[model samples]
Target: MKIRAAVLHSIGAERPFQDTRPLVIEELELDPPGDNEVLVQIKAAGLCHSDLSVIDGNRPRPVPMALGHEAAGIVKAVGSGVRDLKEGDHVVAVFVPSCGHCSPCAEGRPALCEPAAKTNNAGTLVSGEHRLHRDDGTPVNHHLGVSAFADHAVVSRDSLVRIDPALPFHHAALFGCAVLTGVGAVINSANIKAGQTVAVIGLGGVGLNSVLGAMVAGASEVIAFDLDDSKLALATELGASHAFNSKDPDCVEKIKALTKGGVDCAIEMAGSEKALEFAYLITRRGGTTVTGGLAHPEKKVAIQQVSLVAEERTLKGSYVGSCVPVRDVARYVSLFQQGKLPVDKLLTHTLTLDQINEGFERLAAGEAVRQVIEFN
Candidate 1:
């Protein structure tokens, strides 16, 4: 079937994405789902920074690839050998589709499943097949096993988690990435205890979710930092106890003085080495610094080697918030349903497929929080 999708032919396109028009919408032919695969009719898809990274050349991937990852949809059909799901079921797209028998999966860390990473980097499904083709018969690469920028997708059964049909597609879509990564970092990676002081750097969708997660964990002080004051204000309104401008020359000192040293846990959601450095510096002695950001592959952070030993400071990297989607997605959704995780506040704008270029422009400018493309 021919379906409309946003495809990126090259990386590092000029900014003001609407002008350069990096993502070109095209009607591509989608093949039926293979064995153990499910065909999803994408309902809502979020414009995540990961997608922006590809446009700005911060992250590189195969060209002619469908570009959205975080999304929610309905199972239009299921391929042979699929038993747990059926047509009409609602599901969220998980970027990493773990092969249940991988070493990481056995260790309860599907986020790091080796095969998932391999296929993701290769721009194919776990079955190592391309299910999309251009009208010219050229294969289009899948993004993180879910080319959800399209109206439809054929993904591995392992790449989806069923959600309550009552949940709104736009809100449920965020759980696939932003909510999972941000909340997972707090609950799973940090295991933050009540009364702990936490600081989150970079107030985008992921950072704000981290603020909510810290509040849910009972953190007494949730410090929010960002270069943008509007984002800081939004963070404060959500749950951050304090908001600081990361651009301030005295910002680090302010956080240190406020916490009487530093925060118990510091999270960096901005995909920058400098943000990671700030997160590390604002962590208290014996505290943990967690980075959920995805910096360029060649970028590296320079940390004081002695601090890890002397202060017992732990600098850890979090992928998909170290989440087990089948479990975490439902738990987070339950929290959302109970009004504990006010993720709805993060939804700043909704656009149609035609307006997606501008949505990305807003995202690139830090002018929007979580923007979703709602299909007809």
Candidate 2:
């Protein structure tokens, strides 16, 4: 079938342009689903930082890959023996899918499922073949199995998270990645108790959601830190009790004073070493710091083992908020439906597949919180 996609033939350095670039939206074709998979007609997709990292050249990716991970859509067709789901189910596509019998999945940690590397990152499904292709029948590798940048995608049934009929497609797409990462950081990884003081460094898509998660978890105080004043204000609206501009000279002092020495939990959503350092330093004795962001591979972290041992502090690195996507995605959708999670406010703008290059420019300009690509 003919489909429009933001195809990347080469890694983007800065931003995508509409002027005859092969790295942005070079229209392509899509194939039908095979065994244990389903064909989805994508309705909406969320722009995520992970996608940006590739374009910025921070995260190197394979060429000729269709870029998009967070998405929600309707089932257009289901492959053989797919009994649990059928056509017309409103669902959000998860980037990771557990084989259920794999070593990691059997151990109850599907987040570490090895199939993720081969299926999503490598753009080949379990059958060792790709779904989408050019009209001339050349392979255009699928990105993350759910290349929602296109009008349709063929993905594993395990990657599909069915949601309630009440949730909006655009908002539900965010739950697929951002909400899961942020809330999972608090509830799953940290297991934060009530009345604890929390500090969140970085107030972008993931960080703001972490602040929201802290509020929902009944934390006594949620201190938000960000370089952008607009994001600081957005953090407050989302649930932060306080906001701090890290660009200011007294940012660290303000954070220290607010916590009466330091906070009980510090979550670093920024992938920078400096932010990770601050997250550790601002934590009191026995406090925990969780770094959930994906940093460049060559980046090194500096730490004083003495301080960690002497203060009895713990540091953690999290992926996708340590989530089991099937369970977590539904919970997030319910929260949105119940009016507890104001996901709509997190949206800054929406663009089309053709305009994705421009959207990246706006993201670099810090003009929007997220720029979603509507795959209608």
Q: Would you list the C-alpha lDDT of every candidate in the order shown?
A: 0.95, 0.81
**Candidate 1 local lDDT, 166-278, one digit each (tens):** 99999999999999999999989999999999999988999899999999999999999999999999998997889999899998898899999999999999989999999
Which candidate comes out best when scored by lDDT?
A: 1
* TM-score of each candidate structure, all chains considered together: 0.99, 0.95
The segments of candidate 2 whose C-alpha lies over 4 angstroms from its true place after superposition are: 16-23
Give per-residue CA lDDT, model 2, range 317-345, as digits (tens): 87788888888887877777777877788
For residue 210, give model 2's deviation from the true position in Å: 0.8
Clashing pairs in 1: none
RMSD of 2: 1.7
Runs in model 1 with CA error above 4 Å? Answer: none
